[model samples]
Target: MFSYSILLIAALCGAATSDPSTSTDLLWPLPNGNTVGSDMYSLDSKTFMFVPAGKGGSSDVLKEALERYMKLIFLPSPVPALASSITAPMDKLTVTVDSSDETLALNTDNSYMLDTSMSMLSAKTVYGALKGLETFSQLVSTNSMGQFQVPSFKANDVPSFLYRGFMIDTSRHFLEMKTIMDHLDAMAYSKFNVLHWHIVDDQSFPYTSIAFPAMSVKGAYDQNHIYSQDDIAQVIKYAKYRGIRVVVEFDTPGHTQSWGKGIPNLLTPCYANDKPTGTYGPINPTLDSTWTFLHTFFTEIARVFPDSYIHLGGDEVSFLCWESNPDIQKWMKMMNYTNYAQLEQYYETKLLELVKTIGKQYVVWQEIFDNKLEVLPDTVIHVWKGGDNWPKEVYNITKAGLKTLLSSCWYLNYISYGEDWPKYYQCDPLAFNGTAEQQALVVGGEACIWAEYVDSTNFLPRTWPRAGAIAERLWSKTDFSDLHSATTRLHNHRCRLIVRGIPAQPPSGPSFCPHEWEE
Candidate 1:
């Protein structure tokens, strides 16, 4: 029992404090408006009321306001329904959200938290208060069946780490704009704040390059596979509105097969054949003209992407190609370099310095650290290998005074045998044994879904719920819940994903539930 106007007016109120002895009956209120506010139950009076706030505000902000409001008034913890069946008075409560734009706004005590990024997430991503609207939807509704009871609990949640990221590799397979947008919504709902767009690689170059149109023409699978400059701009605009940062990547040297397709001389020949190596092996890092080409390419990228970090991929470069080339070998001895690793170090350092000249930050795989080169100021190192070996690398890199982003525990491409959700959940960003200084340098982690095994068809079901585990790890404290409860909750989360248009099948095999049958 809340009056509609009273509920809407007290949007900023806190939760209730009531006696535990008496049990009050809470029913699923009839859905009335497009917008819904949290229930108002006064602790002192022991009366319950439902209010329908107008729909279409930042769900995150709305949830926060309501959560704070609920803390003052005692009531069962709110759980958003997968779909809103609320009728009549609640018809006005449905908020129309823009799943593509990047700006998200919510007021906490009248203070605004606005996200300005390139790809905005939907309420599902919980990019901000907009996702909070889902909480609001469930707060006013009671359990349809008595199997689930809303509990009375208090929770104080803020992001545990700052740079929660998700990367989309467009090089191997070219995904449609809608597919990318759907993921943006999903990531935001899961509270991910960074979108690492791996735009180009050796396999293919899907980006439309103005300075090098030949790159797209030669490397892209087709004209449709390429993302026009305007398309990229649109994605950036949408992400920013949802408070998501977009980090653009151009994997150089090793993963530059397509780059070689665009510029033939930039590639290194095979060690024995002296013939084109295609997209495989080491690239011609010793070429002066290569640096000139990179300078122009990166300069253009810097002008387009607003994020501080630019990923110059420095992984998987073969040593034979560089060590065998007569010109490279001559240059290495003349430059007083000892081996191939040092030569790679020279290339990485020069590229990093070139990026620095443009006034942007640098991020590369752990290989850069393995090279033992002098650290660039404020560089971010991403750890991708599995287990202790990778974790140890993160420790060493961060201890040496560089920030780190963890991808070791979050590779979604590893696909679940039964369900990998538990394994992903138990991963601790600060779990390794290290000094306080080393721990502090571990910035955050990301859940990555490399495209080798995924496509638009099954990507959502495979990623979600498991990715949700990573989202919680990134957003909540280290010592959260155990795997059992997380698995159970994941079973229920399937319902929520369906409501958000995600094709997530039920956990208990495809045949257990009819909802899993949906295409």
Candidate 2:
């Protein structure tokens, strides 16, 4: 449990707030977007006639449907003045979408144009556009009359990185589907395009593998926390409806303690004082059954997660078991492998190849580079070690022509409010110590929330606003790095988040009870 003093300090130090409402709003769509075409309006009583252009029949349909629903609901309310006043406030807000071919006309007091030529009828594409619209609306604010308005701005914007992501570590402490979906809603709100689900780890295996029922059934927090096949499909469907890609990371070889403890035969054992230990150690890299199990696991995961990338965690393996086993050592010597590193490489490379056969891109931690494993085709490396200097190790991997993801600047769990987030926003993934060609291999990175001491009570507030900062870093232009301006905007954003039901950690400093805002 976080003390009030600690929360206060974090809020003041990090420029965050204690309100979960703000945190929830950090990801939901602004009221204006839904209300503009509907009965609900901004506080200013501004009205709009949103005339969407050719092929914009769908928007027109949604607008009419929403308006009708609003009228129906408001008709019964005794305080018609409240609904009427609310509808009048949105009068000035209007959007005339030109579908003559494909274009979005944002004629706010400020004019903005978006190239929607690629827009399609497919649910995924529509959901993606809606998700973008939600984030775009979050960036807008209201005038004195409570009319939502965007700054006079115009830019043809597209995401620099294809995979703007957040990885929630569920293995440490399981979060319910409602909580997970809430996080997903938050991700969509922040314009985070990818959800890297860390489904398995050393602590537990929360993924339900139908092909191998023994995996999650034996490893989860009882059976309820296990994510069954149906649950996985529902999550994917919901995420797709919001234009989010769900990527699954099943950590292997090293973080397999839960799996090994459950199915002892599937694990490579360690020898403690000359006795074979049942716990997971360096996996039997050359074992035939190991390959078979991994193959089945990947196949099952591939069927579930639609995203093309699969994270095969190749980080942190102890070599005590390999060093002690005489048979393994004899085999290693016979294969001309002089050290344990080579054995690890053998495991990584072969497993990657196996995953490739199943048609999935691979992502690994920087430890893969440290271990000097043979490079897999189209691999992405997530660099976690944070500091002022980019490591020579990361450069070596990118220099060798592999794409990299920069997590060094994006660990949300570092627990700073805005201090660390702006740094993450300022550090360009393409501005590394390698050649432009090598740097071009930078894909993207995520604000990783390692759920060590977090659960439903604290996770949302801890992650938001800061995660929003990182999201803008990944999605918007780098020039949005002004700390002072961001702080003021963030202050309002905190209030907005509160209204939206986000439990974002309040910005620290002096405590002002929210009720006092009116005073």
Alpha-carbon lDDT, every model: 0.60, 0.59
Residue 186 Cα positional deviation in candidate 2, in Å, after optimal superposition: 1.3
Off by over 4 Å in 1: 1-155, 273-280, 507-519
Q: Candidate 2: TM-score?
A: 0.76
The prediction achieving the highest lDDT against the true structure is 1
Give the lDDT of residue 490 in candidate 1: 51
lDDT of 1 by residue, 1-519 (tens): 222221111123321212111111111111111222333221221232223223434445344434433432232322222222222221112223333233432211111121111011123233434433323323332232312122221122346677788888888777788888777766755657788898888768989888989999999888878999999998987676555678888886788878887876887765555544433455687788889898998899998887878888788887877765677778888889887878788788888999999988878888777778666768888898757567688778877888888998788888555646767777888887789898888878888888876767667777775677787787666665545444434544444455456666545343222234245
Candidate 2: 10-residue stretch with minimal lDDT: 75-84
**Per the 3 Å backbone cut-off, how many clashing residue pairs does candidate 1 have?**
78
Per residue, candidate 2 scores C-alpha lDDT tens digits across 53-105 of 33433553335433432332221111001112232332322233333222111
